[model samples]
Target: MGMLKLEARHLLAAAGAAVMISAPASAATLEVHIGSFKNGGTIPSKYAFCVPAAEGHTTGGANINPRISWSKGPRGTKSYAIIVYDNKAPAEHREMMNKEGVTMTADIKRHNFYHWVLVDIPPNVTSIKEGADSNARVVHGKPATPSAAGVKGLNDYTKVMAANDATKGQYYGYDGPCPPWNDDVVHAYHFAVYALSASSLDLPKDFDGPAAEDAMKGKILAQGETVGLYTQNPTKGAKASK
Candidate 1:
């Protein structure tokens, strides 16, 4: 599920950080994880998206999304939200709609890519489907479908992405990878979950990354993360270059 991967790279930390926020009332400490694997766990082969030797290829792996779970969040946590992104992308994080936010490599534009952004998730939610957005799909172009379980946030890719060569459209959800062809390094996808006092954050519907992060400046009570790596290529000699 690499829907808005390009745009999410910029907004996840910058934009989403402020979206759903509330001063935490509980003292619970939330622990992050990947499926059942605890944080800092090994990166699985099936989840590796890039490698040192897989230089010019696109991988057949699912989106970097992982089954996530958390606990010990502060009291009054009415909802939880999730965001997945490539924090290792070049410092080229910015609005994909603007030239300033972009970087050129091999004559192609490579900017921040978005993966998944989910919001309005109820506090009781303890686990996300293993491959929820792995297919890199979405509804009405928003970041995610809110899991029958939550509200999906619009990823940054929607602002400047064009389904066709003619016009740019608003990207509403997850967009998978298309990293630079010559990226000397594999990118790191950071999957973070935030525990909030409310089920949803109060922000504008069409908000971008920086704007959303601003909205949640002080509302998070507890948070944790699950990290995964991804890229267009995989090394042949390694353990699938996970």
Candidate 2:
């Protein structure tokens, strides 16, 4: 009887091992990269909007979208979405910041400024070559062209320039960062990619970042992100006043 009991235990252990071996591998975390800036590194001025300068009008950068690539998405990922957001933008204090002598600081609670939102990227697509999605000058908008691989959504620039007669329009696609010039701290921009289960988001043409995020709620299988920093103030070493 004792021998029989020991054999039964051995069989159960073997069955457990077999089950473990046959189980499918878990999904993997995606890897993302930006060729223009190192992770957590400073973003060049050419990628930002023009700022007033002593010498002449100077742009924060070239206003071109950086080259971005991703790999190792989950096995069943059918499509992808990209959102470039500035977490340090003074969204809540926009009106206050425009007042004379008012300054934005690191201590301020910032808000998301969606600079880019591109979705419905087919699984076969992996990278966006630099400048392919943006122009050297800031255009009012750039709706997804018929030949484009993905759909472009309205960026926060539309709201930022809503009152400006010269720039106000339905800004779309990638519009690089243009933080307040007098801000006391450098702003971090997150470029994140989400792998979705569906082949297409099928969102409306007017969809923005928030709308896209809502649509992708439960469908995201994996995600990856890289951050880049930028500042318009030359006094980078100065600390914000308490």
The models' CA-based lDDT, in order, is 0.51, 0.70
Clashes of 2: 7
lDDT of 2: 0.70
Clashes of each: 44, 7
Q: Which pairs clash inside model 2?
A: 45-60, 45-61, 46-61, 46-62, 47-61, 47-62, 48-61
Model 2 regions lying over 4 Å from their true place? 1-27, 55-61, 96-100, 237-242
Error of 2 at 71 (Å): 0.7
> Per-residue CA lDDT of candidate 1, range 1-242, in tens?
23224433543444334223343465345677777443323344344333223432334343344566777467777887777665545454323311332333422333344556667678777777665644433333434334556655666556535554443555544455444433433445566777776666766666555554555557677876655544432221123333
TM-score computed on alpha carbons, candidate 2? 0.80
Off by over 4 Å in 1: 1-28, 36-56, 59-64, 91-113, 133-146, 163-168, 233-242
